[model samples]
Target: MTNAKTLGQAFDVLLQPDKFRDYGPNGLQVEGDREVKLLVSGVTASRALIEAAIEAQADAIFVHHGLFWRGQDGRIVGWMRERLRLLLTHGIHLFAYHLPLDAHPELGNNAQLGRLLGWQADGRFGDQDLGFLGVSTQPWSRPQALADHVSAVLSRPVTCVGDMGQQVRRVAWCTGGAQGYFEAAIAQGVDAFITGEISEPQAHLARETGVAFLACGHHATERYGAPAVAARVAQDLGLQHRFIDIDNPA
Candidate 1:
Protein backbone atom coordinates (compact mmCIF):
# COMPACT_ATOMS: atom_id res chain seq x y z
CA MET A 1 0.00 0.00 0.00
CA THR A 2 1.20 3.51 -0.84
CA ASN A 3 -0.01 7.12 -0.63
CA ALA A 4 -2.54 7.52 -3.46
CA LYS A 5 -2.98 11.29 -3.39
CA THR A 6 0.77 11.82 -3.70
CA LEU A 7 0.79 9.65 -6.81
CA GLY A 8 -2.08 11.52 -8.47
CA GLN A 9 -0.44 14.89 -7.90
CA ALA A 10 2.83 13.71 -9.44
CA PHE A 11 1.12 12.26 -12.52
CA ASP A 12 -0.92 15.42 -13.07
CA VAL A 13 2.20 17.59 -12.92
CA LEU A 14 4.13 15.29 -15.25
CA LEU A 15 1.33 14.66 -17.78
CA GLN A 16 -0.28 18.16 -17.70
CA PRO A 17 -3.61 17.21 -19.33
CA ASP A 18 -4.61 20.88 -19.68
CA LYS A 19 -1.78 21.41 -22.18
CA PHE A 20 -3.55 19.48 -24.93
CA ARG A 21 -7.11 19.95 -26.13
CA ASP A 22 -7.71 16.21 -26.16
CA TYR A 23 -10.42 14.17 -27.86
CA GLY A 24 -11.41 12.75 -24.47
CA PRO A 25 -10.76 13.62 -20.87
CA ASN A 26 -7.37 13.12 -19.25
CA GLY A 27 -5.90 12.84 -15.78
CA LEU A 28 -8.26 10.97 -13.50
CA GLN A 29 -11.27 10.74 -15.77
CA VAL A 30 -13.03 8.31 -13.40
CA GLU A 31 -13.06 9.02 -9.72
CA GLY A 32 -12.21 6.59 -6.96
CA ASP A 33 -10.65 7.33 -3.61
CA ARG A 34 -8.81 10.65 -3.47
CA GLU A 35 -5.52 8.92 -2.72
CA VAL A 36 -4.00 5.77 -4.25
CA LYS A 37 -1.20 3.29 -3.63
CA LEU A 38 -0.80 0.73 -6.39
CA LEU A 39 -1.62 1.75 -9.96
CA VAL A 40 -2.50 -0.44 -12.92
CA SER A 41 -1.65 1.00 -16.33
CA GLY A 42 -2.50 -0.29 -19.79
CA VAL A 43 -3.14 0.69 -23.41
CA THR A 44 -6.93 0.71 -23.15
CA ALA A 45 -9.41 0.61 -20.30
CA SER A 46 -11.42 -2.43 -21.30
CA ARG A 47 -13.17 -4.99 -19.10
CA ALA A 48 -10.15 -7.26 -18.96
CA LEU A 49 -7.91 -4.42 -17.87
CA ILE A 50 -10.33 -3.44 -15.17
CA GLU A 51 -10.54 -7.02 -13.99
CA ALA A 52 -6.79 -7.13 -13.79
CA ALA A 53 -6.86 -3.94 -11.77
CA ILE A 54 -9.28 -5.49 -9.34
CA GLU A 55 -7.11 -8.55 -8.97
CA ALA A 56 -4.09 -6.40 -8.33
CA GLN A 57 -6.09 -4.38 -5.84
CA ALA A 58 -4.87 -1.27 -7.56
CA ASP A 59 -5.85 2.16 -6.34
CA ALA A 60 -6.04 3.51 -9.86
CA ILE A 61 -5.69 2.52 -13.52
CA PHE A 62 -3.96 4.76 -16.05
CA VAL A 63 -4.73 4.10 -19.66
CA HIS A 64 -4.28 5.61 -23.14
CA HIS A 65 -7.93 5.12 -24.13
CA GLY A 66 -10.84 5.29 -21.69
CA LEU A 67 -14.59 4.86 -22.06
CA PHE A 68 -17.13 7.65 -22.79
CA TRP A 69 -16.13 8.30 -26.40
CA ARG A 70 -17.19 11.25 -28.53
CA GLY A 71 -20.43 9.69 -29.83
CA GLN A 72 -21.03 7.21 -27.09
CA ASP A 73 -24.64 7.76 -26.21
CA GLY A 74 -25.02 8.95 -22.65
CA ARG A 75 -26.81 5.61 -22.12
CA ILE A 76 -25.08 3.24 -19.76
CA VAL A 77 -26.19 -0.09 -21.22
CA GLY A 78 -24.79 -3.14 -23.04
CA TRP A 79 -20.96 -3.24 -23.36
CA MET A 80 -20.52 0.15 -21.76
CA ARG A 81 -22.63 -0.93 -18.83
CA GLU A 82 -20.51 -3.97 -18.07
CA ARG A 83 -17.26 -2.04 -18.21
CA LEU A 84 -18.47 0.83 -16.10
CA ARG A 85 -19.97 -1.54 -13.60
CA LEU A 86 -16.61 -3.25 -13.25
CA LEU A 87 -14.73 0.00 -12.69
CA LEU A 88 -17.20 1.52 -10.25
CA THR A 89 -17.80 -1.65 -8.33
CA HIS A 90 -14.09 -2.25 -8.03
CA GLY A 91 -13.60 1.25 -6.68
CA ILE A 92 -10.75 1.82 -9.12
CA HIS A 93 -10.07 5.29 -10.48
CA LEU A 94 -9.46 5.52 -14.20
CA PHE A 95 -7.31 8.25 -15.75
CA ALA A 96 -7.10 8.46 -19.50
CA TYR A 97 -4.79 10.78 -21.43
CA HIS A 98 -5.74 10.63 -25.09
CA LEU A 99 -4.16 13.28 -27.34
CA PRO A 100 -2.44 14.76 -24.33
CA LEU A 101 -0.41 11.58 -23.89
CA ASP A 102 0.48 11.74 -27.57
CA ALA A 103 1.38 15.43 -27.32
CA HIS A 104 3.73 15.28 -24.35
CA PRO A 105 7.22 16.39 -25.41
CA GLU A 106 9.49 14.50 -23.04
CA LEU A 107 7.22 11.66 -21.99
CA GLY A 108 4.93 11.22 -25.01
CA ASN A 109 4.97 8.03 -27.08
CA ASN A 110 6.42 9.85 -30.11
CA ALA A 111 9.14 11.51 -28.07
CA GLN A 112 10.20 8.22 -26.47
CA LEU A 113 10.19 6.44 -29.85
CA GLY A 114 12.17 9.25 -31.49
CA ARG A 115 14.86 8.90 -28.84
CA LEU A 116 14.75 5.13 -29.20
CA LEU A 117 15.23 5.40 -32.96
CA GLY A 118 17.66 8.30 -32.64
CA TRP A 119 15.47 10.55 -34.76
CA GLN A 120 15.87 14.32 -34.41
CA ALA A 121 12.36 15.27 -33.27
CA ASP A 122 10.57 18.05 -35.08
CA GLY A 123 7.82 18.96 -32.66
CA ARG A 124 4.16 18.47 -33.73
CA PHE A 125 2.39 20.00 -36.72
CA GLY A 126 -1.14 21.50 -37.09
CA ASP A 127 -2.57 23.06 -33.92
CA GLN A 128 1.04 22.83 -32.88
CA ASP A 129 0.73 19.04 -32.45
CA LEU A 130 3.50 17.12 -30.68
CA GLY A 131 4.05 13.75 -32.33
CA PHE A 132 7.68 13.61 -33.49
CA LEU A 133 8.40 13.70 -37.22
CA GLY A 134 11.99 14.38 -38.15
CA VAL A 135 15.00 13.61 -40.35
CA SER A 136 17.29 10.71 -39.69
CA THR A 137 20.93 11.71 -39.63
CA GLN A 138 21.84 8.27 -40.95
CA PRO A 139 19.67 5.86 -42.88
CA TRP A 140 18.86 2.67 -41.00
CA SER A 141 20.52 -0.61 -41.97
CA ARG A 142 17.41 -1.17 -44.08
CA PRO A 143 13.65 -0.77 -43.74
CA GLN A 144 13.39 -4.37 -42.57
CA ALA A 145 16.18 -3.78 -40.11
CA LEU A 146 14.41 -0.79 -38.65
CA ALA A 147 11.07 -2.57 -38.60
CA ASP A 148 12.74 -5.47 -36.88
CA HIS A 149 14.25 -3.09 -34.38
CA VAL A 150 10.86 -1.51 -33.78
CA SER A 151 9.35 -4.97 -33.26
CA ALA A 152 12.07 -5.78 -30.75
CA VAL A 153 11.62 -2.51 -28.91
CA LEU A 154 7.83 -2.50 -28.91
CA SER A 155 7.55 -6.18 -27.95
CA ARG A 156 5.24 -7.03 -30.85
CA PRO A 157 5.52 -7.67 -34.56
CA VAL A 158 4.67 -4.70 -36.80
CA THR A 159 2.79 -4.98 -40.07
CA CYS A 160 4.92 -3.64 -42.92
CA VAL A 161 2.70 -1.85 -45.48
CA GLY A 162 5.20 -1.11 -48.23
CA ASP A 163 7.78 -3.13 -50.02
CA MET A 164 10.30 -4.84 -47.76
CA GLY A 165 12.90 -3.89 -50.37
CA GLN A 166 12.06 -0.21 -49.89
CA GLN A 167 14.37 2.13 -47.97
CA VAL A 168 13.22 4.65 -45.36
CA ARG A 169 13.95 8.36 -45.30
CA ARG A 170 12.19 11.17 -43.44
CA VAL A 171 9.44 9.40 -41.49
CA ALA A 172 6.43 10.78 -39.64
CA TRP A 173 4.73 8.82 -36.88
CA CYS A 174 2.10 8.97 -34.12
CA THR A 175 1.71 6.14 -31.68
CA GLY A 176 -1.33 4.02 -30.66
CA GLY A 177 -3.60 3.04 -33.51
CA ALA A 178 -3.34 6.23 -35.53
CA GLN A 179 -3.29 4.70 -39.01
CA GLY A 180 -6.17 7.01 -39.85
CA TYR A 181 -3.64 9.85 -40.01
CA PHE A 182 -1.61 8.32 -42.84
CA GLU A 183 -2.98 10.84 -45.30
CA ALA A 184 -1.84 13.70 -43.11
CA ALA A 185 1.69 12.29 -43.01
CA ILE A 186 1.64 11.83 -46.76
CA ALA A 187 0.60 15.45 -47.20
CA GLN A 188 3.76 16.32 -45.31
CA GLY A 189 5.69 14.37 -48.00
CA VAL A 190 7.10 11.82 -45.65
CA ASP A 191 9.08 8.89 -46.97
CA ALA A 192 7.28 6.72 -44.45
CA PHE A 193 4.44 6.98 -41.97
CA ILE A 194 4.47 4.91 -38.78
CA THR A 195 1.60 4.33 -36.40
CA GLY A 196 -0.32 1.67 -34.52
CA GLU A 197 -3.11 -0.36 -36.20
CA ILE A 198 -4.04 -0.55 -39.89
CA SER A 199 -7.12 -0.80 -42.06
CA GLU A 200 -7.81 -1.89 -45.65
CA PRO A 201 -8.02 1.76 -46.66
CA GLN A 202 -4.53 2.28 -45.31
CA ALA A 203 -3.08 0.05 -48.01
CA HIS A 204 -4.83 1.98 -50.79
CA LEU A 205 -3.74 5.25 -49.23
CA ALA A 206 -0.13 4.17 -48.81
CA ARG A 207 0.29 3.22 -52.44
CA GLU A 208 -1.64 6.22 -53.68
CA THR A 209 0.21 8.65 -51.45
CA GLY A 210 3.62 7.06 -52.18
CA VAL A 211 4.42 6.88 -48.49
CA ALA A 212 5.43 3.72 -46.66
CA PHE A 213 3.15 2.79 -43.77
CA LEU A 214 3.76 0.58 -40.77
CA ALA A 215 1.17 -0.61 -38.20
CA CYS A 216 3.21 -1.22 -35.11
CA GLY A 217 0.28 -2.42 -32.96
CA HIS A 218 -2.01 -0.11 -30.97
CA HIS A 219 -1.07 -1.56 -27.60
CA ALA A 220 2.64 -1.76 -28.38
CA THR A 221 3.06 1.79 -29.65
CA GLU A 222 1.32 3.49 -26.74
CA ARG A 223 2.89 1.87 -23.67
CA TYR A 224 5.39 4.66 -23.09
CA GLY A 225 3.08 7.14 -21.39
CA ALA A 226 1.86 4.90 -18.57
CA PRO A 227 5.37 3.76 -17.71
CA ALA A 228 6.76 7.25 -17.82
CA VAL A 229 3.81 8.40 -15.75
CA ALA A 230 4.49 5.57 -13.34
CA ALA A 231 8.15 6.49 -13.09
CA ARG A 232 7.34 10.10 -12.34
CA VAL A 233 4.93 8.98 -9.66
CA ALA A 234 7.61 6.81 -8.16
CA GLN A 235 10.24 9.54 -8.20
CA ASP A 236 8.01 12.21 -6.74
CA LEU A 237 6.62 9.97 -4.03
CA GLY A 238 9.64 7.69 -3.55
CA LEU A 239 7.59 4.50 -3.79
CA GLN A 240 8.51 0.98 -4.81
CA HIS A 241 7.44 0.42 -8.40
CA ARG A 242 7.38 -1.81 -11.46
CA PHE A 243 5.73 -1.12 -14.83
CA ILE A 244 3.61 -4.13 -15.71
CA ASP A 245 3.46 -4.69 -19.47
CA ILE A 246 0.31 -6.60 -20.47
CA ASP A 247 1.34 -7.98 -23.86
CA ASN A 248 -1.31 -7.16 -26.43
CA PRO A 249 -0.98 -8.22 -30.10
CA ALA A 250 -3.66 -5.91 -31.48
Candidate 2:
Protein backbone atom coordinates (compact mmCIF):
# COMPACT_ATOMS: atom_id res chain seq x y z
CA MET A 1 0.00 0.00 0.00
CA THR A 2 1.12 3.54 -0.81
CA ASN A 3 0.21 6.76 0.92
CA ALA A 4 -2.57 8.69 -0.81
CA LYS A 5 -0.62 11.95 -0.49
CA THR A 6 2.31 10.35 -2.35
CA LEU A 7 0.00 9.34 -5.18
CA GLY A 8 -1.37 12.87 -5.42
CA GLN A 9 2.11 14.38 -5.35
CA ALA A 10 3.27 12.02 -8.07
CA PHE A 11 0.41 13.07 -10.32
CA ASP A 12 1.06 16.73 -9.66
CA VAL A 13 4.69 16.30 -10.62
CA LEU A 14 3.85 14.48 -13.83
CA LEU A 15 0.81 16.49 -14.95
CA GLN A 16 1.78 19.92 -13.51
CA PRO A 17 -1.87 20.97 -13.10
CA ASP A 18 -0.94 24.52 -12.11
CA LYS A 19 0.34 25.26 -15.63
CA PHE A 20 -3.16 25.60 -17.05
CA ARG A 21 -6.06 27.73 -15.86
CA ASP A 22 -8.56 24.89 -16.04
CA TYR A 23 -12.31 24.91 -15.55
CA GLY A 24 -12.05 23.00 -12.25
CA PRO A 25 -9.66 22.04 -9.48
CA ASN A 26 -6.96 19.63 -10.65
CA GLY A 27 -5.67 17.73 -7.63
CA LEU A 28 -7.24 15.71 -4.84
CA GLN A 29 -10.90 16.79 -4.95
CA VAL A 30 -12.16 14.33 -2.32
CA GLU A 31 -10.09 12.97 0.53
CA GLY A 32 -10.41 9.34 1.44
CA ASP A 33 -8.25 6.56 2.84
CA ARG A 34 -4.73 7.74 3.62
CA GLU A 35 -3.36 4.46 2.38
CA VAL A 36 -4.23 3.46 -1.14
CA LYS A 37 -3.49 -0.05 -2.32
CA LEU A 38 -5.75 -0.17 -5.36
CA LEU A 39 -6.29 2.74 -7.75
CA VAL A 40 -9.23 2.80 -10.13
CA SER A 41 -9.07 5.01 -13.22
CA GLY A 42 -11.87 6.13 -15.52
CA VAL A 43 -12.87 8.84 -17.99
CA THR A 44 -15.35 10.47 -15.62
CA ALA A 45 -16.23 10.25 -11.95
CA SER A 46 -19.92 9.60 -12.49
CA ARG A 47 -22.03 7.65 -9.97
CA ALA A 48 -21.58 4.46 -11.99
CA LEU A 49 -17.79 4.77 -12.02
CA ILE A 50 -17.66 5.44 -8.27
CA GLU A 51 -19.83 2.39 -7.65
CA ALA A 52 -17.50 0.35 -9.83
CA ALA A 53 -14.50 1.57 -7.82
CA ILE A 54 -16.29 0.63 -4.61
CA GLU A 55 -17.03 -2.84 -6.00
CA ALA A 56 -13.42 -3.28 -6.99
CA GLN A 57 -12.23 -2.28 -3.47
CA ALA A 58 -10.29 0.67 -4.78
CA ASP A 59 -8.82 2.98 -2.20
CA ALA A 60 -8.39 5.82 -4.70
CA ILE A 61 -10.04 6.95 -7.95
CA PHE A 62 -8.37 8.94 -10.73
CA VAL A 63 -10.30 10.50 -13.55
CA HIS A 64 -10.29 13.23 -16.20
CA HIS A 65 -13.73 14.62 -15.29
CA GLY A 66 -14.27 15.06 -11.56
CA LEU A 67 -17.23 15.85 -9.30
CA PHE A 68 -16.66 19.62 -9.11
CA TRP A 69 -16.11 22.41 -11.60
CA ARG A 70 -15.79 26.18 -11.53
CA GLY A 71 -19.02 28.19 -11.94
CA GLN A 72 -21.05 25.30 -10.52
CA ASP A 73 -23.46 25.58 -7.62
CA GLY A 74 -21.53 25.51 -4.34
CA ARG A 75 -24.35 23.91 -2.39
CA ILE A 76 -23.89 20.19 -1.98
CA VAL A 77 -27.35 18.83 -2.85
CA GLY A 78 -29.02 16.44 -5.26
CA TRP A 79 -26.51 14.51 -7.40
CA MET A 80 -23.51 16.26 -5.92
CA ARG A 81 -24.33 15.31 -2.35
CA GLU A 82 -24.94 11.69 -3.28
CA ARG A 83 -21.69 11.42 -5.21
CA LEU A 84 -19.70 12.97 -2.39
CA ARG A 85 -21.47 10.81 0.17
CA LEU A 86 -20.32 7.71 -1.68
CA LEU A 87 -16.68 8.79 -1.71
CA LEU A 88 -16.69 9.99 1.90
CA THR A 89 -18.58 6.97 3.14
CA HIS A 90 -16.39 4.51 1.25
CA GLY A 91 -13.12 6.38 1.86
CA ILE A 92 -12.09 6.52 -1.77
CA HIS A 93 -9.66 9.29 -2.64
CA LEU A 94 -10.53 11.28 -5.77
CA PHE A 95 -7.84 12.81 -8.00
CA ALA A 96 -8.92 14.63 -11.13
CA TYR A 97 -6.76 16.31 -13.78
CA HIS A 98 -8.60 18.22 -16.49
CA LEU A 99 -6.48 20.36 -18.83
CA PRO A 100 -3.21 18.87 -17.65
CA LEU A 101 -4.40 15.41 -18.56
CA ASP A 102 -5.41 16.61 -22.00
CA ALA A 103 -2.17 18.41 -22.83
CA HIS A 104 0.47 16.03 -21.52
CA PRO A 105 3.05 15.12 -24.14
CA GLU A 106 2.83 11.31 -24.01
CA LEU A 107 -0.01 10.17 -21.78
CA GLY A 108 -2.46 13.00 -22.52
CA ASN A 109 -5.79 12.66 -24.33
CA ASN A 110 -4.51 14.28 -27.54
CA ALA A 111 -1.29 12.27 -27.59
CA GLN A 112 -2.99 8.97 -26.77
CA LEU A 113 -5.74 9.57 -29.32
CA GLY A 114 -3.11 10.41 -31.94
CA ARG A 115 -1.23 7.24 -31.02
CA LEU A 116 -4.41 5.24 -31.47
CA LEU A 117 -5.32 6.90 -34.80
CA GLY A 118 -1.73 6.90 -36.12
CA TRP A 119 -1.42 10.69 -36.23
CA GLN A 120 1.78 12.50 -35.27
CA ALA A 121 1.44 15.87 -33.55
CA ASP A 122 3.81 18.41 -35.07
CA GLY A 123 2.54 21.51 -33.24
CA ARG A 124 -0.12 22.89 -30.88
CA PHE A 125 -2.73 25.68 -31.00
CA GLY A 126 -5.89 26.99 -29.28
CA ASP A 127 -6.28 27.97 -25.62
CA GLN A 128 -3.43 26.70 -23.42
CA ASP A 129 -2.18 24.94 -26.55
CA LEU A 130 -4.73 22.18 -26.10
CA GLY A 131 -5.21 21.67 -29.85
CA PHE A 132 -2.78 19.53 -31.87
CA LEU A 133 -1.64 20.04 -35.46
CA GLY A 134 -0.53 16.83 -37.12
CA VAL A 135 -0.51 14.60 -40.15
CA SER A 136 -1.99 11.13 -40.60
CA THR A 137 0.74 8.48 -40.86
CA GLN A 138 -0.97 7.17 -43.97
CA PRO A 139 -2.84 9.69 -46.11
CA TRP A 140 -6.45 8.72 -46.71
CA SER A 141 -7.63 9.09 -50.30
CA ARG A 142 -10.84 10.72 -49.10
CA PRO A 143 -12.27 12.25 -45.94
CA GLN A 144 -14.72 9.32 -45.75
CA ALA A 145 -11.82 6.85 -45.50
CA LEU A 146 -10.28 8.73 -42.57
CA ALA A 147 -13.71 8.92 -40.91
CA ASP A 148 -14.22 5.19 -41.47
CA HIS A 149 -10.82 4.40 -39.96
CA VAL A 150 -11.50 6.59 -36.93
CA SER A 151 -14.96 5.08 -36.42
CA ALA A 152 -13.52 1.57 -36.60
CA VAL A 153 -10.69 2.41 -34.21
CA LEU A 154 -12.95 4.10 -31.66
CA SER A 155 -15.92 1.75 -32.11
CA ARG A 156 -18.33 4.67 -32.45
CA PRO A 157 -19.99 6.51 -35.29
CA VAL A 158 -17.96 9.55 -36.43
CA THR A 159 -19.88 12.51 -37.85
CA CYS A 160 -17.90 13.76 -40.84
CA VAL A 161 -18.66 17.12 -42.51
CA GLY A 162 -17.36 18.86 -45.65
CA ASP A 163 -16.71 17.31 -49.06
CA MET A 164 -16.65 13.52 -48.79
CA GLY A 165 -14.15 13.39 -51.62
CA GLN A 166 -11.74 15.83 -49.98
CA GLN A 167 -8.31 14.25 -49.49
CA VAL A 168 -7.14 14.01 -45.84
CA ARG A 169 -3.38 14.37 -45.38
CA ARG A 170 -2.46 17.13 -42.93
CA VAL A 171 -4.73 17.03 -39.85
CA ALA A 172 -5.48 18.88 -36.63
CA TRP A 173 -7.30 17.54 -33.56
CA CYS A 174 -8.21 18.20 -29.96
CA THR A 175 -10.22 15.71 -27.93
CA GLY A 176 -13.44 16.21 -25.90
CA GLY A 177 -15.75 19.06 -26.85
CA ALA A 178 -13.05 20.94 -28.74
CA GLN A 179 -15.08 21.92 -31.81
CA GLY A 180 -14.35 25.54 -31.02
CA TYR A 181 -10.75 24.98 -32.11
CA PHE A 182 -11.91 24.18 -35.65
CA GLU A 183 -11.38 27.69 -36.98
CA ALA A 184 -7.89 28.02 -35.51
CA ALA A 185 -7.01 24.64 -37.00
CA ILE A 186 -8.27 25.72 -40.40
CA ALA A 187 -6.03 28.78 -40.22
CA GLN A 188 -3.06 26.42 -39.95
CA GLY A 189 -3.89 25.11 -43.42
CA VAL A 190 -4.61 21.51 -42.44
CA ASP A 191 -6.68 19.38 -44.79
CA ALA A 192 -8.86 17.99 -41.96
CA PHE A 193 -9.75 18.71 -38.35
CA ILE A 194 -10.90 16.04 -35.84
CA THR A 195 -12.47 16.71 -32.48
CA GLY A 196 -14.73 14.97 -29.96
CA GLU A 197 -17.78 17.04 -30.91
CA ILE A 198 -18.85 19.34 -33.71
CA SER A 199 -20.94 22.51 -33.49
CA GLU A 200 -23.40 23.87 -36.10
CA PRO A 201 -21.00 26.59 -37.22
CA GLN A 202 -18.29 23.98 -37.93
CA ALA A 203 -20.42 22.32 -40.62
CA HIS A 204 -20.84 25.60 -42.46
CA LEU A 205 -17.17 26.47 -41.98
CA ALA A 206 -16.07 23.08 -43.29
CA ARG A 207 -18.12 23.61 -46.45
CA GLU A 208 -16.92 27.17 -46.96
CA THR A 209 -13.25 26.55 -46.16
CA GLY A 210 -13.11 23.12 -47.82
CA VAL A 211 -11.60 21.60 -44.65
CA ALA A 212 -13.00 18.27 -43.47
CA PHE A 213 -14.35 17.90 -39.93
CA LEU A 214 -14.77 14.66 -38.02
CA ALA A 215 -16.71 14.57 -34.76
CA CYS A 216 -15.76 11.55 -32.71
CA GLY A 217 -17.64 11.01 -29.46
CA HIS A 218 -16.25 13.08 -26.60
CA HIS A 219 -16.09 10.29 -24.02
CA ALA A 220 -14.79 7.79 -26.55
CA THR A 221 -11.86 9.98 -27.60
CA GLU A 222 -10.90 10.84 -23.99
CA ARG A 223 -10.93 7.28 -22.65
CA TYR A 224 -7.20 6.69 -22.95
CA GLY A 225 -5.42 9.46 -20.97
CA ALA A 226 -6.63 8.63 -17.47
CA PRO A 227 -6.00 4.93 -17.84
CA ALA A 228 -2.61 5.47 -19.44
CA VAL A 229 -1.41 7.86 -16.73
CA ALA A 230 -2.94 5.82 -13.92
CA ALA A 231 -1.35 2.57 -15.08
CA ARG A 232 2.07 4.16 -15.27
CA VAL A 233 1.74 5.66 -11.82
CA ALA A 234 0.48 2.40 -10.39
CA GLN A 235 3.40 0.52 -11.91
CA ASP A 236 5.93 2.98 -10.61
CA LEU A 237 4.44 3.09 -7.12
CA GLY A 238 3.74 -0.66 -6.83
CA LEU A 239 0.01 -0.24 -6.53
CA GLN A 240 -2.65 -2.32 -8.22
CA HIS A 241 -4.64 -0.47 -10.86
CA ARG A 242 -7.93 -1.16 -12.60
CA PHE A 243 -9.42 0.88 -15.42
CA ILE A 244 -13.21 0.75 -15.37
CA ASP A 245 -14.81 1.84 -18.63
CA ILE A 246 -18.33 2.97 -17.91
CA ASP A 247 -19.86 3.20 -21.37
CA ASN A 248 -20.81 6.73 -22.35
CA PRO A 249 -22.48 7.27 -25.73
CA ALA A 250 -21.85 11.01 -25.58
User: Residue by residue across 188-248, what tens digits does model 2's lDDT show?
Assistant: 9999999999889999999998899999999999999999999999999999999999999
Quote the positional error of residue 178 for candidate 2 in Å: 0.4
Candidate 1 deviates by what RMSD?
2.8
lDDT of 2: 0.94
The model with the greatest TM-score is 2
Candidate-wise lDDT, in order: 0.73, 0.94
lDDT measured at residue 194 in model 2 versus the true structure, 0 to 100: 91
Q: How close is candidate 2 to the true structure, as a TM-score?
A: 0.98
